[model samples]
Target chain A: GESVGLHLPTLSVQEGDNSIINCAYSNSASDYFIWYKQESGKGPQFIIDIRSNMDKRQGQRVTVLLNKTVKHLSLQIAATQPGDSAVYFCAEKDAGNMLTFGGGTRLMVKP
Target chain B: DAGITQSPRYKITETGRQVTLMCHQTWSHSYMFWYRQDLGHGLRLIYYSAAADITDKGEVPDGYVVSRSKTENFPLTLESATRSQTSVYFCASAVKETQYFGPGTRLLVL
Candidate 1:
């Protein structure tokens, strides 16, 4: 069984500032990790993903860092905006192709 | 391109009532998954289908049923709905390692 959890339940950030959301997983065999942004009244949308072999992967405005040693994962948003206000979730995929998601962290962007 | 879609974006049902949520994907992907999203639980897998006529139980499959008669459609059914089953249901299809999700169906069991 895999256990994915977020360090913070809610994160408040100022507009134009950077935001960081952290996640921890219990499974050491997890090889793939993904970040999803879920808006109110919508399903979780894919943000970014990083493989266990790589420590970091960058997207347009988001970056995902995976630390296998500590079983830690983090999503960093650059120049956060109001649109970035959403619940962010981290999920780890097992060898069987099943994904286990974390509790999620609500990101609030304050203007 | 309507990659994926779920029917009855919002549904309200009563306890012991039968309800079904429909999911369709245009990508023709081989894998389809059903998940329920609840507060403090993020998303939990309910059921998944590897291909047409091939289904498997996921993390949580109690009180739920799924069938894939065609590659383009997968429907989740609750034989007898319960309040605890009230949550946003999501459908996704995988392309290699990445999975693309549908808009989701919000189910409320009264």
Candidate 2:
């Protein structure tokens, strides 16, 4: 089965620095994409989402970029904080409204 | 009081035992979903219900059964529990576009 994957399993960055998480998806028909952040001992929390028609979308401190041609998605965090340390996953919505998630990337922020 | 909740925050059971996880949401969201999270992997959907009595299988729906008797409750039952079924289970409800997740239930099967 084709699945989404992360470019790196783990990422480390200094607090207050910028961080980027990359994901590659194999499904072409996917129309919706979402980014979720999961802390230890908790469920995944929605961060940001984008549709196929849009190329970029931004939230308070998070930005989601989508490239359908290359089947790539990325989440950029500005001024990464200590609370930002968590596992990040990129999920794509298939034709049947089912979401397929990537392996996830764990982010570590060092003070 | 208006968020999703999962009962039995933590549980341990022996293999071949039947265990059921309960999920409840205060919001009258029409869509409810069940997902399991494992180490080194993202959350995978087991089952989702569009409405009451309208349920469908998801990517990894084997060894699990789900029923939506009411709009706010979606329960997942493991008919024959296995060690491999040990994972953190999360329930989510979607009213519009984004889905809100619960705290999650941790199950350990020996």
Best by DockQ: 1
Candidate 1 chain A least-lDDT 10 residues: A93-102
- The DockQ for candidate 1, computed on C-alphas, is 0.76
lDDT of 2 by residue, A9-60 (tens): 9999999999999999998988889999999998889999999999999999
Give me candidate 1's TM-score against the actual structure.
0.96
Screening candidate 2 with a backbone cut-off below 3 angstroms (N, C-alpha, C), the clashing residue pairs are none
- Misplaced by over 4 Å in model 1 are none
- Tens-place lDDT digits, model 2, residues B1-110: 75999988999999999999999999999999999988766678899999999999887899999999899999999999999999999999997557889999999999
Local error of candidate 1 at residue B78 (angstroms): 1.2
Can you write out model 1's per-residue Cα lDDT over B1-110, one digit (the tens) per residue? 99999999999999999999999999999999999988667688999999999999998999999999999999999999999999999999996667889999999999
Model 2 chain B, poorest ten-residue lDDT window? Answer: B37-46
